[model samples]
Target: MTQHVNEFIQQGLRVLDIERAGIDDITPSINQDFAQACELMLNCRGRVVVTGMGKSGHIGNKIAATLASTGTPAFFMHPGEASHGDLGMITATDVVLAMSNSGETSEVISIVPVIKRLGVTLISMTGNPQSTLARAADVHINVAVQTEACPLGLAPTASTTAALVMGDALAVALLHARGFTADDFALSHPGGSLGRRLLLRVSDIMHEGERLPKVRHDAIIKDALLEISRKGLGMTAVVDDNDVLLGIFTDGDLRRILDQQVDVHTTSIASVMTARCITAKPEMLAAEALKLMEDKKINGLVVVNKQQCPVGAFNMHDLLRAGVI
Candidate 1:
């Protein structure tokens, strides 16, 4: 478009490239120290106490959260606050993870002796391995960056990104070590959309009781059509005397029947309904139900109990409203 706009775009992409290359440079440090740090946290019986100063504090906070959500229990502790009585939050069995780009933030360094005295394992992530904090820690993982994304090289850009990605790498490593599943993750994030998809069941959103569009197998086509219209599910389940789902008659079936000019008043629904319809169970995960609907090229499903009796019914619209779609 314009020269100034092109310069702005180029500058943004340049910064991104610098940050990505900085991340790539961090790969070699995922060696012994990193493994030992992960092992220390994994075997720990108590929580991980993460501490930092300034921008590192912000990155440490996010790291702590990622670790907690991924099955490694952790929390952020401001190093300055920790010296002022917050140190009590850490137990002898706990592990302390400290972040400092220079490996020499005074606030974090001042509390190292107390952490050591408490007999807590210390892990340090720093841009300089030879810094004081790294030497004091039981394990040190270098997060050195080759360049800063900042044009003036005065801001915490690439270094902070490296630390954040390192933290995520640690969290996911622990998550896999514990065999953490999506169900476990969902429990920790029940308010999020992922939780809804994993935790919700067919029975939770399905229409049951009188809301179900169902009719006897011997019921006339007109009766089934009335049930479909009343239930508004675009389909009707044909059931036997015990309410076991025998077949399904959908609007598609109605279209075919109309083309044949079948007498609605005289023809039994069982004669034209599609038997052996795909069905879902009441306890089936809502996400799984959606997969079934998609793979079978259908829009709705009937939830049946163990006895093959129709318990509930739902369609894609129901899943959309439930946020499972």
Candidate 2:
């Protein structure tokens, strides 16, 4: 590589190293004020209004999202916008989380009087405890770092990382205090795959009624094969006259039967089916089904009702397409 490229790479690595060190330095400082911040947010009846400027604003937005998704009600308000008309978003019952590395960001500090006038509890995350923002806050979290990762010590690198970690710490502390579960997190993040895994149940994605691939106990292998092909699930469930599942025959079973030269036209599905097949219930979470599939080394499952009758059937492909994979 060129000398200039090598120098750039070295500088980037140094910056990351410094930022990581900064995060490590603030571990011991996460007491008292951290707890106070969590208490303030937990007691908040309205919402958390996070405000910042420039790069701090970007990090504040992400912090607000993390807090919101993890059970804390939070939203980001750019200081500039708040100065315009967005200050109406804040209520006296809410809590304000302000981010500023130097604790003296003019745009953020300028709005303190309005926030204070609204009687909203204020929590400040700043690298400088003696700075104006920290002194003005009800609870000041000292996210101090030794130095910036920027070689010139002018960029936000290490200071921003310290602030972000502090924000995460507060969110998680509140999340645990509120008994937030994966289901709760999923509810707030419905667009992501994690949401599907936690919120979706087998019944939500399984093929039910006419879509289920099922055959009677007396079904001929040819008829069962046709049902499997028609359903496109690569398997057909074998059940008794009363719809109680007896066994299942999959593409793997057909391959084994064909090796023995068992004629599909003459054979009965029950004769070649494997009983005691793995199954799941409609009430079970889809993520649990995924784990069962992985553990049993199987790709599909029959969803049984309380009577153990096959109410639905689904395969790995169904989960993959449903965003539960």
Candidate 3:
């Protein structure tokens, strides 16, 4: 068992080392051809149609998704399917990105004449720049690797990794060239946690009205404690008769007051509360509010309006529940 475990570890490391070298070898391929491909895709009037076969098809699908999400409209078409009826998906204004490790995949090469006939810009990513597909493309990116990570040299290991890295390079370069912002990324991923953090506002997740935890400035410490417990936010806002916020009292304050032996029944909540504490605006991004809370070392915040009144309140738990933490 010990000998087998050592063999497994050694083989895993060997694979990783070879794959890393393969990626490093392709770094020089991001040259004039890559820049020209990006220029064509950036100025394309229609979507980018990505096509490949077998292992390259899987990588092409991922590349197309990354492009679509990062401001470039793109989709993957199986090269075999393109020779059937899917060739209709390509247009003269669109750009075609084809991938094949050997640069001679019969299925991919079979459709090149039709793609050229449509006058669509053709970009090829292959390990052999001298092969037919690479020679036929308007732009060719060489993703050649020294050797396969597989000990047998039969599996598509290092070559697929090199292609994946090159695809990422293209996607990120186009993303930057298009000036895609975080807001634009959030718009494309509204159902994901990143979108929730970037798009959700304090007002959307905060407890307002009857759910808000607040007490009068003259209210006793016991009254503030009761309000905090009732609202379940671990804190309460202290406000005057005009409904303007004066201060905030939290569970931490209770601990400090307990050490001082203050009378909870008679002591005014305002006397021991944190005055002018950290606050959030209703329109503030939940991500920004989270940063503020983290920077201030606080777990809760009072949401104030333009009139300095506490309109809502929330705690770390609320952010966690809303997937903003």
Candidate 4:
């Protein structure tokens, strides 16, 4: 049993090695054809129509999604369905990206003439350059693999990976061509951690108005402690009459002052507070603020305006809840 298990592991490794070699072989093919494919999709006035069948269909779906999220407008269509009503999804303004390892996937080959009739530019990805699909396309990108990871040399493993990589190459190239920014990516992906990191601002999560833990500079240490406890932020801002931030007194400061036996009821907050506190701007990205907090070795920050007035406050817990952590 142990010997059998060892063989299984070795077989998996061998498969990986073969697939890696296949990918390496395709690296040089990121050539003129690849460039033309990108340019065609970039200039496409309509959505990219990606189509294939079987394993190729699965890879096509992923390519379509990556293209859509990165900047290109694209969606996958089953070549089998294209013969039915789904062909209507493709317009003369669109571009068709067809994939087939053999360059003879019957479903994909069957749609070739119809795609041509619609006046849609066809870009084909295939391993066999001389195959029908390759010959029919306006531009042919060769994703040929020297070998399959499958011991029988039949599974789609290496070829699918090469095709997937080719799709990513095209999407990223188009992304660069269109000047697609991370902000634009965030707009497309508003629910994930990427969106939280890119789209959320300090002002969106910080405690504002009456919720701000604040005490007058002239107020006693006891007043600041009351504000901190009431606000539950572990710190209180020592501010002037205009609410401009003067200093901050956190629990860390309170702990240090405990060793000095300071009188909480009598000592003015201004005397005990940190005069120069690290602060964040309301417009600052929350993820950038998290990095700032990590670099400064602090857990909380006061959100200030252009004039340095305290507008809001936040802590590590807020970042965790907002998924910025």
Candidate 5:
């Protein structure tokens, strides 16, 4: 039993090694048809319809999502469903991207005839160049691998990896050709953390109006401390008579003041507050503010306007709440 387990582990490692090698081998091929694939997808007016069967179907679904999120409009359709009225989803303006390892998946191949009959552009990703799907396609991208990662050469391992990588290559190439920006990506993934970091601004997360931790510059340090305590932001913004920002006093400043035995009751916040404080505009990205805080080794910031007036305040806690951390 011990020897059998050892053999199994060895075979597993061998499979992984072969799969990695197969990925390396396909790099050159990716460069070959990459430009042509991008041109076809970029010029496509309608959605990219991805179809496959079995393990290939799983890879096809992921590829479709990657394409859709990266500026290409795409969706996956199970070829089995195409036989039962899903064929209506395809149109003359749409482009069809079909995936199969052998290039002869009957379920996928069956749809090829109908797709071609409709005069839709057909792009096939397969290992065998002479296979039916490849011959029928308007563009055939070869994603061939040396061998399957399975020990008995039965499982879909390296082949699927190659197909998936090829799909990603196509999507990213199209993304670059289309000049897709981070804002565009955020729009597609608005609910995810990446979207929150990119789309959310300081104004969206900062405490505004009555929630702003602020005090007049003429106010005593003790009064400012009370405002900080009330707002629970560990700091308070010091503003001028016209409500323009002057400086800020934080918990760190309080510690420094206590070290010098400064009188909180008699000392004005303007006297002890740190001027030239780092601040962010309300229109700036919250992610940029988060970086500033991390780089400065601080936990909080005051949001200001073009006139350097305190409009809002935020801290690491706010970033956590807003999902920008």
Candidate 6:
């Protein structure tokens, strides 16, 4: 049993080594042809239609999704469906990106004539440069691998990896050319956690109004502790009569005071609070606020307005509950 387990591990490692080498071999293929392919897609007035068959189709689907999320309008179309009637999805203004290991997929090649007739820009990623698909394309990206990870060399292992990496290379290159920003990506992925982190503001999840934890600077530590407990924010903002931020008191401060044997009822919060503390604007991004808390080694922040008045308060637990952490 031990020998069998060791053999299994060795086989997995060997497969990984071959795939890595295949990826390395394709690095040189990122040449003029790759740049031209990106240029065609970047300048495209319509979407990029990606099509492939079998294993290549799966990779094509992922490539299309990546392109769309990164600011390039793209979608996957199966080659088999294209011949049956889905070809209408392609427009003259659109660019057709076809993937095939051998560059001779019959379904893919069968549509080459129609693609050319429509005057659509054709970009082909294939292992065989001399194959029909490559010869018909305006731009051809070579994704040929020396060998497959499969011992039989019949499966589309290393070849598919090379093609997928090339597709990612194209998408990222176009993303840079278009100056796609993180904000733009967030817009496309609004339903995901990434979008929540980018789009949520400090005011969105902060405890405001009566829920805000705050106390007057003249208030004793005991009073601030009560406010903190009532608000359940683990901290309380120290403010002046005008509601202007003065300082902050937290559980950590309470610990220090207890060790010093200070009288919570007589000691004013201002005297024991953090005078020069980190604060966040209500309009600031939640992700930015989270980073500030992490960098300053604090667990909470007081959200203030332009006048530096405490308007809201939140802690690490708030961010976690809001899925911003």
CA lDDT for candidate 3? 0.95
What C-alpha RMSD separates each model from the true structure? 2.0, 2.2, 2.1, 1.6, 2.1, 1.6
In model 6, residue pairs whose N, Cα or C atoms come closer than 3 Å (at least 3 residues apart or on different chains), thus clashing, are none
Query: Model 4, 130-249: lDDT tens per residue?
Result: 999999999999999998887787778989999998888999999999999988999999998889999999999999999999999999999888899999999988899997899999
Which candidate do you rate higher for lDDT, 2 or 6?
A: 6
TM-score of each: 0.93, 0.91, 0.92, 0.95, 0.93, 0.95
Model 5 whole-model lDDT (C-alpha atoms): 0.92
Candidate 5 regions exceeding 4 Å error are: 1-13
Model 3 clash pairs? none
List lDDT for all candidates, in order: 0.95, 0.92, 0.95, 0.93, 0.92, 0.93
Runs of candidate 4 exceeding 4 Å displacement:
192-194
RMSD of 1: 2.0
lDDT of 1 by residue, 1-325 (tens): 5769989999999999999999999999999989999999999999999999999999999999999999999999999898789998999989999999999999999999998888999999999999999999999999999999998999999999999999999999999999999889999999968889989989899999999999998899999999999999999999999888899999999999999999999999999999999999988999999999999999999888889998889999999999998
Question: Which digits, one per residue and each the tens of the lDDT, describe model 3 over residues 191-249?
Answer: 97888998899999999999999999999999899999999999999999999999999
Give the alpha carbon lDDT tens digit for every residue of 143-167 in model 6.
9999899999998999999999999
- lDDT string, candidate 5, 25-144, tens digits: 678776646667677889999999999999999999999999999999999999999999999999899999999989999999888888988999999899898999989888888888
How well does model 4 score by local distance difference test? Answer: 0.93
Show model 2 residue runs off by greater than 4 Å.
4-9, 192-194
lDDT of 6: 0.93
lDDT of 5 at 43: 97
lDDT of 5 at 145: 88
lDDT of 5 at 169: 88
